[model samples]
Target chain A: MTVSLRVLDDGAWVSVNDAREVSVSELWRLDDPSFCGCDLPDFVVENVLSVGVDGRTVTANVYGQCIGCGETGVPGWVPVGRLSDGKFVDIDRENTVLPVYDGDDR
Target chain B: MPTDVERWKSEVYGTEIREHLFRFAEEGWDAIPEDERDAWFERFKWWGLYHQRNGQESYFMLRIGTPNGRLEPGQLRVVGEVAKEYATGPGTNPIFGDAYADFTTRQSIQLHWIKLEDVPAIFEKLEAHGLSAQQACGDSWRNIVGNPMAGDDATEVIDAWPVIQELNETFKGNDDHSNLPRKWKVSVTGTPDGSGQGDINDLALEPAYKEIDGEEQVGFNVRVGGGLARNEPRLARDIDVWVAPEDAAAVAGGLSALFRDHGDRENRYNARIKFLVDEWGTEKLRETLQEDYVDFELETAGDDLRDQYTYNAGGEGRNDLLGVHEQKDGSNFVGLNVLVGRMGADDVIQLADLAEQYGSGAARLTQRQNVIVPDIPDGELDDFLAEDLLEHYSPEPSPFMRGSVACTGTEFCSLSIVETKNRQVRFARWLKENVDLPEGVEEFHIHLSGCTASCAQPQIADVSLRGMKTRKDGEPVEALDIGLGGGLGEEPQFARWVTQRVPVDEVPGAIENLLANFDDQRDGTETFREFVLRHDDDELADLVEPEETSYEDPMMHNTKRTWYPYAEDDELDASPAPSLADGTPITSDD
Candidate 1:
């Protein structure tokens, strides 16, 4: 099974199999201390730089700002969603306290 | 390796895409393979059909590129008819209603809610009336923008209408120049008031004079690699190269070819020529063009007319083309303000009628998102002004109403974070009704762009508003990052983002308070831009006092999460999209 992953529309969206799965402007509760000093950065996803797969979990590198700390940068590889049977499954980014992974491993 | 877009373009792009497009339109929406939808959608932008954002599938925003924004004779009627007939959908905007035409900041017309099935018919109508969408949106020579009053402007240094027409004919569909790493925006300015806004285009040809063998020769001075997008703003750089009016197209082609060969293809974000210019500098770019691209010898920089620039300069002079102005032929051209740049379909048709009855049946769109009716003689000026349509699209509009510009936000664009057009409309109306401009300030520009794309040209306004998100009372609400003191003229300046993340509802109050401060602390008759220039960023940010006010913002919630921000249900699940030819929602079985 194959799932095509790409970021199109000038980083405004993350397209999974020609469908816009994740979009910018969504406020996410991110658990990434490296991105900012805050324990939990209430980050706004401004631009989706790239998307890739780390096993079945779909990860994305996004550019945005931590509203709490007023720090702006990419929050490494945040698991935006999961791929199940070659189909993208949505992550409730608004509710989910998404854990950030070290992006350098990619 | 090339990017997906580059590979897609290599496989099929330019004039070849039109055949597939026509076939798809004829065969219906389901004819397209599901896996190839993204590639096809991206390619469709070449023909000026942009696939609307998520939740709105099978519909497009159709752009008709009227060269230099010139709609000759009966062309405006055709656009209005296209909008009325094909530009409608399940969702209706409460403000703009069922069908409306958007006059873009790029001097083009955009009709939203266009079904793939209706594209052939719409293109047919537009073609019959001498208009085209080819190379309007995608990474090609986009719509050639210039002084809307090109031929008729009394203040013009040279009549650039012929030159503009020649360039349009040469590059629009030419196979060699049809593809590039990024979108190419060109401007040819002949007017001294700097109406063409050449400072912010990929390529600019501003009027200049050069001495050739002891005789004064009229031509254009070249500038390149200027654009505002993705938080990177740059004014076009003077390359110290001038070209005669006859050699303009040749030099343009050469520079474009230079961009095509050298511009970065791997990173779409860094593909704009502005980035290339950053790496190479103006000297290297000019050297490369001279060495490789062109056959003829390029002239050194000539004496330019930059000192005379006034349009959108943020001073006391004419910043916009609103109100009646004189033509070179001793006639009148009326510039009407189309607030937020969206006009309902019927009003569009009516305006076309008025243009025919009053002027030379020609209408031009300006970079300020306004319309100009040219060649109106003194005899018919009074009757044209008295028309009921002009009351709404007024030549003499309030300064707030006159200066309000916005981009298509979450309503249609994928790049947008918040609702823009209607919100700006509401903001303008509220400001017009409630607040007064500080004494002697006739023009106060407030531009609202939905995101970092900067489609509203927010950086060049008195008050710039870019979309963002902020928490209000433990709930996420739509917000704007407010900037101040940006404009174009003899000197161009991008707005300074002094205040960050202001809730949308409190924006009007902030503007009101900021203006009140300006009114109180001015040194005597200094313009708003001047006052802003004198103050530091900290002082300016402090001046922006955001508070709750009588002016309400309907789109406080996350508009990007909705199918249509203005729709009654306004939910992602409630969308009737990815529809069939008859607009019946397509059900998918997994």
Candidate 2:
């Protein structure tokens, strides 16, 4: 089954199969220390640059800043959620410490 | 590969989208297929109907494009009546009430909480009054902006209203120029005061004098590819071509075609003609237009009147279209400041009545999100000014109130991260009550744009504020990035982002401190923009001292997650959306 993924409304949100699944303006904690100076990078998503599904693990490349150090740029692909049986499964992204799939590796 | 938006536009777009829009309107909201909802919503923008943000599912934001912001006799009343009757839903704005109209910076009107079912009737009502939303929001020629009182202003170089009308009629419905690579914004300024802010448009026609047929004739010099959006700001570059008033439409059409054919379609981020201009400088752009796009020879650049331009220049003359200005016909045109550009429907109707009673029924909207009532005779000037309606929408308001401009933020727009209009209104009111301007300083512009989309034109103001986020006491809160010293004039400048992320609560205090620092350290009678230009970025940053003051921001939490920021129960699950025509929520069990 094809899970249609899109970044709509001028990069405001990510839609999986025409349903708004993940949106910008949400704060997430990135486990990567290089992303910012804090013990954990406190990331706020300003724009959903693009989205993809790698092995049912949904990843969103976003453009925003870390509140800890005020560093602004695209910080790799942060996992937002996952797809199960071609259906999007929500994760507690705002509460979890997610790992960043660095652009260097991709 | 083309982006999803490009693919959607390629498949079904432009004027043809209207037929399907009406069909879906008649059949109801659910008639649109679930899988195709995104595509249809994207297409609906061509008709000026934008699907409201995530939680508010079925409602739409309807934008009515008034070419040159010109409202004919009695047309103003029609818009007010439309707002009162149809622009209502469950949510009510705390500041603007349930039904109101927003005057946009590009000289257009927007009404929120519009249901798709009522669109056909609304279109009929709007069409009856010579108003439309066609090509208003999509990738086409958005509302043509210029001096609000183009033909009537006594200080204008030449009457450009007829030329604006000709261009509006030529390209508005023409299929040849209706579909472009990205949104095409055009500005035609007949006035030398630069009220149109032509430097920030994709296509600009600024007044000039050219030697044609051995005589000095007044025409317009062409510029292309200026926009402030997506973290990239560019001033429209001079293309070294000039056009007569009669041939303006041809040149505009040709350039629109040039952008349509050559602009990047694959990457939406790199799609604006500004990027294309950045890629192929002005010389090649002009060469391409002369060689392939146009049939006749184009004239070389003419002598421009840049030295006389001072509207919002952070200097003395005509900072904005506020107060009364003399018209050519021994009459006056009053520029009323609509705070944050949002006016209630009752005020709109009363103003329409006042316009017919005291002046010409014709009204116009300025690029600063204000309104102008033209043709008020000398005898009726005192009476018109005395009207109770003018008290709120004052012609001579405080500089803080008049200079405040904001974009539609998290309230109804999807791309905005924070609440804007109400917050700016609060900021302006507090500033008016608390802060005092330095000696000889009257106008202090502070524009608040919710994001880098730059809809509020934040990059060209005395104080610029864009939405951001920060952690306040271990909780995420709304914040703003502060910028200083940007204005348009003989020499235009973009505001430098001095302070990074200041909490929303501290923004007013930050402004107050910045002003105090300028007062303490600046030379006599130096303007804020001048003061900013004197110092480096780090020095300016030090001047912006963000502290907690008595001014409180009610929306400190994340507003984007809510269904409506002002609602009593604003949680996404508490929304009564995806509803039927009668305002009944449609549940899955239904």
| Candidate-wise lDDT, in order | 0.92, 0.92
Give residue B498's error in model 1 in angstroms.
Answer: 0.3
Positional deviation of B125 in candidate 2, in angstroms?
A: 0.6
C-alpha lDDT (0 to 100) for residue B59 of candidate 2 = 94
Candidate 1 lDDT (Cα, whole model)? Answer: 0.92
What is the per-residue lDDT of model 1 for residues B143-163, given as tens digits with 9 covering 90 to 100?
Answer: 999998898888888888888
* Chain B: TM-scores of all predictions: 0.99, 0.99
Tens digits of per-residue lDDT for model 2, B467-578: 9988889888999999999999999999999998799999999999999999999898888999999999999999999989999999999999899999999999999998
Estimated TM-score for each candidate = 0.99, 0.99
Docking class of 2: medium
Quality of candidate 1 docking, DockQ? 0.81
Q: Write the per-residue lDDT of candidate 2 for residues A58-94, one digit (tens) a residue.
A: 9999998888898878888888889988888999998
